[model samples]
Structures are given as structure tokens and as C-alpha cells.
Target: MPVRTSPADAPLRIAVVADSDTRWKWGALTARRIAGRPPELAGFLLRGRATPTPRQLAEVGVAADALREVTMAEFLRAAEREPYDVVVLALVGGAAQAALHGLARLWPGHARRPVLVTGYVGVVYEKLADGLLLRHGADVVLANSRHDAERFRAVYEGVGADAAAVTEAALPFLGGAPHTPEPGRDTVVFAAQPSVPESRADRMYLLRRLIGHARRHPERDVLLKLRSKPGEHTTHIEEQPYQKLARSLDPPPNFRLVYGNMGEVLDRTDLLVTVSSTAALESLHRSVPTAVLTDLGVREALGNHHFIGSGCLASWDQLDAGHRPSPDPRWLAAQGVAPGEAYEGAFDAVRARLAELLARPALAPVSPYYTPVTAPGYLPGILARHHLAPDGTPLPGAAPETEATGVRRLVRDAVRDAARGAYRHGVQRVAPVIRRMGEL
Candidate 1:
């Protein structure tokens, strides 16, 4: 008998594990767009458990009625009972890799798993998870950065990712309409997100200090703008909560919490300010001055000079003195990427690749997920050449064989070592769902 057709009937099962509300919002949007409709949807919020608020529901068109608060374990159980066609997992921070373990435990007996949509957060955790998921089951690993894609293949699980299947995508802004240009106004801007949580604490502090400096220096018209993408595009309002909080005291004439067209705001601006946002990198291509405010966490995560060379990373004192915050604009263009270009091309490529990889001729059901490595016995050997001992033990006594190697030699060794190490001592097992930041 011929079956009736409906977008909801043959929907792909997408499970998102996100570290923040924003990522989850975007992940859910992407899933609905790709999968079609309500009945076919399955999503898991990595953090908050509950249905979307009224505004949240309206923001994404998710049927609040259809949304469920199922745990990772519960989602997995349901997935097995009615086998989803694909699973999209959006993750960030420390929670991403852990979420995969939760998923693996649920499907303890399934053989052929669904296609996975991965949105990884940091380079460190992505590698940790990639080694695991690729070795065990994931059919596809969607990374947000080419660097991350390569890293996943090079170190984590060489065989875990299909080079052809790996698609480098942009970090989606979800629903806010992007900023358009305004006729004539210099509005070079610096972007910081209060919502980024403690991960951006250093940056947050630096921003506050700059605002204080602006109060004293009355000539520079420094604009501090928060990032507002297409999904939740809000008009520039001086009275907004974040702005009110940022500029609690009456600010000086030069400093402002500007709003409206971000593109126009940035395009007209003379300079940009930030810590490690990819936006700072993008502004450089647009020829805006960018500066990075550094502290302990930023220094530890990414070196200062690293972003400075790319543009938009600078010292506040330098910026206060009317000193531009960039060296070469071309370098910025070379490193920075536009979200539209990144998401439209990279993300689409991933979706298409996913469809291709799992096509009938290529499709194969693989595993019931498992994290057998928390204990020493089943641990996958994760041998980082940077710290590998004679017997493959990781420690301070690993001797740092190539830590002091020459530049050319270092690059060569990094490449060579990554491959050799993956083949020799790779042990991390990640869930099929993961992400890579585009800035990498």
C-alpha cells in the first residue's frame, strides 16, 4: 500500500545539547528548518529543562505543545523505540562531551545509529569527544571550523570523521536580522555578550574598565555594542537591562551604549573592542580598529598576540590614546569570516553532505553508544605528543620532547605527531554530536 506523505511523518530526529540558551535556540531553529515539522522533532536542552517560554516559543515557531522536557537518557530510549533518521547535537563548554556519554547510555543495544548534527564549543573538548564518537559510532561529525574539522580528523578519531562528511559551519545567530548599513556615520564598535556567562568574565571586566575610562576621557566616542544577530534582532535601546547594567553610573559624553544597525554601527566605527570574540576578527576585514582586553583566563585560553595579529585585539590604553587597534587589514580579512557567508555555505554543505553520507547506498546503522573510558581499564589511549612519557603516561615528567622545537620543526611535528599519536594512543570517545568554534 502506498503511504500518505507529510513533512512530519518522516522527520529526522535531532537532539541538541547546548551549554547556553542561545545555542539551544539556534540549534532548534536549524533542526526545524531541516527536518520540516512538529511531530518529527525531538530536542534536548543541555542546560535548562522545561518548555520554552511564550516569547521563546514565538521566537522559534516551536510548538510549545509539542516540546518536551525529556532527559538525555529519556530521549535515547525514545529514539530507540521509534528510530530517528538523524540526530543533531549542539554543544558548548564542559557540558558537550559529557552530554554524549548520557546519550550513549540510553541506546545500550541499538546497532545502526541516526545521523548526527554536531556544534562543538571549544577546541580542547572537541578533540576529547571526537576520538570517542568516531571510534564508536557517529556517521558524521559537523564541526564549525575548518581548523576544528582538521583537528578532529588529525587527533581525536582519524577514522571517526569522514573528511567528505565533515562540514565546517558558522556559529548561527539564529533569529536576529543582521545589521544593514546607514548612510554616513562612523560607528566603529566593540561587541561583548553579557550572556556568555563566566567564560567571558575577563572580557566583561575589561569592558567595564573601558567604560570607566570613557567617563574620564570626554573626547573619544566609544561605542560598546552587544551582539544581536538575525534571530532576536532588537532595536538599539539605551534603557535595556544589559546596557543599564554596563553603564550604571552616568557615563561621560564620549562613551555610549549604542543600538540599531550593527553593520552600520560597526561600519561607521573607527575601532572595535573585545577579548576573544570572532566579531573582533570580522571587524578587521571591514577596516575597523579592534582591540583585545586581556586578563588571566584569556591569557590562559588564547595568547594575546595571537588575536592582535588578526585585528581587533588591542590594549584599552592604546585605544584611549586615539591609537588604532590593528596592524594589517588583509590579515584580518584572511582570518575573519562573515556569519552569512559562513552559515549559508558551510552549514548548507553540512546538511547536504549529511544527506549524501547517509544515502541508501552509503547508509549503515552502527552502534549503541558507550563511554567505557572513565575507568582506567577501558580508557582509550589519548597520547598528546606534547606530553607523552616513555611508556605513554601523560604528566609533567613527559619531558616535553618537542615543546622547544623550532617553528618550522614545530609545525611539521604538530602535523606529524597528531597523526602518529592518533594512530598510536588515541583514547577519547565522544558522542556523535559535537561542535567546533569557527574562530579556530
Candidate 2:
């Protein structure tokens, strides 16, 4: 393959591929931040179980120069056909790995490929090793905080993989004015996750507590900041929605469910509370009096364990008693919550690394850790899920017809809707019953 080179002053053409609303927000924002100047941005939303709806995209409010939905195979084909300065894989671990391997196959030998980047959307509490290794082959694997960057490097080095790819960066969505106490009405927002408190009972318990808090303090406006509506899917599967749980117990007028941009909601919020959502970090970044609920216990399963030393842990009882938790300054700094210049410069390293990569005469092929030789048993299954062979070639019938039209398009949409409905039904209705039966 011939060397693919471009002038240093040329405008960058960046592409971002994301799976869900949250990742899309992270990817789009990160792309802009690292682009140095406004570059040509193209967004690809992967068609998957958690594909964000139009409403979800609107709620996120991050626009790309061009946006479309594509399957993993389709995206590979597009990448092969087009040339991009940078490609951000804002996908889950398996999908990212699949794409990396497939891109390597498409752009083999000395062919210059785009600077590949992948990272978590927010706090990294679960699947440290598995996820990190899957994202190992990206040219840059972003770590959202210093703490995470250290852990990511440790994991890669421990596994005998290159640790140089771990780049320290802050979550792209972390920005808002410092929280100011409202003079007349104190707004308390509970940031709700789709599946953190997975059980109906646990969700009901939290809702009842929120309602109790509202009843106890009628003067204060309590808001349930929901991530998604009943039908919309997010990063995680919402087995039991708080909206449905709230209906069982009629809540006070002052307490209501609200959905929109989290930053906008945080603008008026005095107290922000959550189980383990990334909203806690966002709230802390803005100096909001944030609380991580300990009612569910600070267990790893709940992910509140990540806040163990942050000094933000509090129960509903404590919150109701007017005990607002303040984050430790040291913890805040380590978590990349530094305000002003520090926050602004978080993506500086990423930009520099990208500039270096893009300036190279010819780059090596995408070398993911999980290859046919490395994990013969596991790698193939992951690729097969995305309709790619172990060697990264698309399987038969993997590509969809070019833009289904008329009746065909309508039928396709209907089938997708039915599939989504079935998934929701299984999650919200059937899964809980099965779990209860297992408990017996």
C-alpha cells in the first residue's frame, strides 16, 4: 500500500461512531474538543439494541456535520471507501474491538489509516480488564480521569500490552456554572439511572423515599431527572422505570419527573443525588451539593463504591435531614473535576497525540490485542455478533439494501419497532418475574 499523506495545514475530516445517546454525546463533544479547530465531523450511530431515538438525540443536543445510522459491517465499508483524519469509536468494548480489527483488515500493509480513538463515556467502575483490552488497539484510548488513566495503564501493562495508548482526558459533558442556592425555591434533583437499581422493589423503595422527601419538605422543589422516557433506551437497559414505579405511589405536586439536558437541569439544581450515575461527577464538577445514595449500600454492584472516598455518600434519611455532602477537594482534583484552566486543558494531550499521528508519513495497521492468534476462542464470537468473520470480512447478507424505500422502508421500521417492544417487554415485565422465581 502507498503512503497516504496530507498537508499539515489541511482541515481534519473526523468521523465518530457511537452506539447510544450517552456515548454519542461523549463522542461528538470529544471530537470537537480534540479537533483543535472546527473540522469536518461525520457521525455514525450504530444500529443496535440501544440505538438512540430522535428524541434522545435531540435531548443530547450535540450535532455532527453529517449523521447517519449504520451497522458494524456497513461502517467498515464506509471507512474503507472514505478517508478521515481521525475516527472516534464511541462504542462498547466488543463493538470497538470488532471495528478496530475490521479496519485493520481493510487498510492493510503500509496503508495510512485514520487515527483511531476509543474511550468510556464516564466513570469506569465495571469491566476494567475486559473492556480495556477490547479497546486496546485504538491509537488513543482515552481515560476520563487521572485515576482511571492510572488504572487503565496498569491493566494494559499487567497484561503485557502497550500502555502508551491511555490518554488522560475529562468527561466531555462536564461543564456548568457553580451551583447557587435559589432564593425562594430550593430545587433538589435525583439523577435517575435506567438500570442501577435494577429491581422493581428497589426502584419503588427509592421513589417512595423521594416522595417522602417531597412530602416532608413541600417548600423545596424536588425533581426526578429521568435519563429516558418509558420507551427510549439508553446506555443501559431500564428493567424497571422510575416513571412506572412512581405511578404506584401518587407523589406530591412539588415533586415531578423531568427530562431534558442534564446540564440545563443542573443549572437550577441546589442538591444533586444519584446511586452511581455519571451525573454525580457532573454535579461535583459544577460544585453542586451532590450525594451518592447509600441506602442501597456502597457496594460494587451499585457502583456507589467508586465514591467511597469522595465524601459524597449519604442516605435518603441523611438527605431528608438536610445533610448535604461536600466532595473532598483532593478527590475532585484526581477525578479531573478541576475547574477553569485545568478543565479546559484536559483534552490537550489527546490533541497533541492526534496531531503527531496525523503527521506521520505512513502508519501501521490497526493492531488490536485480541486477534485470531491471541484469543482464538473468544475473538471470533465477538466479531460474529457484528456479522464479521474472524479475519474481519463481512458475512453474506450482512449489508442492508441501500436506503429501503416506500413499503420496504415501512416494513423495516415496523419490524424494528416490534423488536424494540419485545425487548422492553422482556426487560420490564418478564425478566423481573424470572429473577423473583430464582430467588425462591
Candidate 3:
């Protein structure tokens, strides 16, 4: 039996556990829209780069008290003190996956163990293993599109996940009405993924292609939008920065490196290109000419093979020939790109489902396999010992980083980077082995 709580008297308390700006943005937007007046929102972020940026805070207009940095142990401790009604995991990484497994272990049997919801921030094609874990770990998994939801459902069924957990939801980062392409703006933006900027050879090839495109269309202003500023770490550490390449190449006057508001940049952008980014999808939603560059093979992480047959890709040859990319009507319908009738149906369904969840005062669905005692086996024992106890109590005096901890982290990062390079180069044969190493 569901307890119909009064929205005015007792607002639903939501805790957004996130470690990235992209994920936090989604959580903040959802809270702003869904949390009734006098918002009961607490944004718990991990320390360092994961902390919400001032710009991000301004964009969402999140209350100062609402956003705070907390260590994993601290967050767990606070949850034990006063649990939220809903815990939204705004994460999509190995760390987040591991954290979810830990949270599942720590919260079971608690009186106020909130319903957990996890979601991807953007397009997901080849990352099925993590996707499966996220789906099974959370009480509800938010899918960005109908195609994605169906795909996740099929995978969840295959993985023996509870079939009732998935729900289709729009990405809150893309909040405004559908973008209409403006006239007289002949700007082309290559949404750069500086973090893990493909292979060195691939990077050079892409730069050369963009340069060639600019040469062919001198009237077009081409902007290379960087993922982060030089020396700044965001999610993945970039071994090679595009700024260095841009400086060496000495691109044409029309070609420039850009970093600022993505929406504003897209407003003036007539054409958008990327290896595989959420930006490509955003551009498509705006009705702009969007191209998924696939000079890299389908097997490569940046291939973006999902859009291959969808008519959104500009292959190496296509880029060379200066061909205009077109979107497949059927693909758009299947992908749930909106302003269409299909999107409206999906959006309404998601809102209705969310309303039903909000109506209930508590969301506690326990899993026999994920109790705190069992979670340490899935994650590293060290993480479990450092973060929480079997009875959901956070370990004391383990929250702060000491000098020794900092030194150890530096060494660990170097090793991880080396292993990542080896994995990228195909030196590592087993996917599971690499996945486990990634968790480390």
C-alpha cells in the first residue's frame, strides 16, 4: 500500500549523488523541475574535480546549502543519519558503478533506504557491461530514448535484471524547446573530446580532415570546441591536448579553438561534428546538420557506429569529399528525437511514471545479492573497509586525505594510465581483465 504524501506539507527529499558536472547538471535540472516549491534537494559531490563548479551552480540556480562536497564515507554516514526519499545516482563510470554496488550493500534493511535511480547522461552503444550493472543495481534506470530503453530492457532480461525497473526519460541538460536552425550563421563546430583524444594518429587525421573541410568551405567558420581547458582534469585525464595541435597546425583564420557555453555556440553553429558525443545528439535535436565522424573503425571506442546506417555519419571518405550529412527519418523516430509525436508519448510516459514514484513516501526495494556484507566482494575490500561497515555505519577518521594518501594516489594514477594505454593498444586481450583493472 502506497502512502499518498501531501506535497505541500512534506516535500519529497532527493539526494543527487554525482561526481561529474554532466551528471550533476542532470540531477540539478530534474530536482529544479520535479521538487515542488521549497525544494528538498541535497547535492552530494565527491571532492576534487567532481565538486560542482560555480558556473554549474549558477546555471541550475541551486541553493548554496543544497550543494556540498563529501567523501564517500561521509556521504554514507549522513545517509545513515537522515535518509532521503529518493537517491538519484547521476553517474556513468566504473567508479559510480562500484559506488552503487557499495550503496546497495550499505542501505539494505534500513528504515529509510530510498529508491535508487541511475541513468546515462548521453548516447551509449558499446558499453554494455557497465550498462547492465547500472540497470540491475538501481531500483529504476532512466533511458534517454525509446530505442535505448528497449535495448536496455533486452539486455536487462538477458542479464536477469528485474524487467520493471527501466523508464524512458528526457535528458534534463537539453531542457529548452527544440532548437530551430537560424539563417546566415555559417559556423561549423567540431565538438572535441580532448579527454582520451583517440589515438595520436587518429587525432592528426581528424585535425587534417577538419582543416581540409575549412579550406574547401572558406565561408564557413569552424570552431574546435575543447572538452576542458589545458591542465584541467575532467573525468578522464587527457594525454594529448587539442590546444597543442591547434597551435602547431596554425589553422586558418576561420578556424579557432573555443570553450564557453555550449548552447550559445550551437545557436550559431550550422554544422556540428564529433567522433561520438552527446553534443551530436543535441545538434540533431536542434535540426542542425550533425555528423558523427568515423575515421576510426567501428571497433574503436570513438567509432559511433550507432549512427552509421542512420545517415548521420561523415566517414573519412565523406569528410574528404565535403559531403553534406542527412538524418534518417526512421532512425529519428526510433531514437525518440523530439518535436515528433513519438517523443511526446515517451515524455508523457516518463512524467506519469515519475509522478507515481513521487506520490509514494518511500522507495525501498531490497536485493538479496547486494546487501552491505556481500557488496565488498563485488567492489574492492579496501574500498568497502574505507567507506562503510556491514551495519551501514561509515568508518570513522577515514574521510580526510593525508599526505601519504596523496602520494599513494599519484602512484596509483600513473599505473592506471599505463594500463589504460595498454588496453587501448590491444595489448590486453581479455575484456574482463581490463574491466577489473579499470575498477582498480
Per-candidate TM equals 0.58, 0.96, 0.78
Which lDDT tens digits does candidate 1 get at residues 295-319?
4334534434445345444566666
Tens digit per residue, CA lDDT, model 2, 101-182: 8888987776677899999998888899999999998899999999999999999999899899999988988888887776
List residue ranges in candidate 2 displaced over 4 A: 1-7, 434-440
Please count the clashing residue pairs in each candidate, in the order shown: 36, 0, 2
Candidate 2 scores a C-alpha RMSD against the true structure in Å of 1.8
- Candidate 3's residue-wise lDDT over 246-284, tens digit each? 677867888888877567678788778888877877777
**Candidate 3 residue runs with Cα over 4 Å from true position:** 1-11, 33-39, 48-65, 97-107, 110-113, 175-183, 316-322, 340-345, 368-377, 389-393, 400-440
Candidate 1: residue 128 lDDT (0-100): 50
Candidate RMSDs in order: 16.2, 1.8, 7.0
Q: Lowest lDDT 10-mer window, candidate 3?
A: 423-432
Best by lDDT: 2
lDDT of 1 at 5: 31
Q: How big is the positional error of residue 310 in model 1, measured in Å on the Cα after superposition?
A: 1.1
Comparison by lDDT, 2 against 3, better one: 2
Clashing pairs in 3: 105-371, 105-372
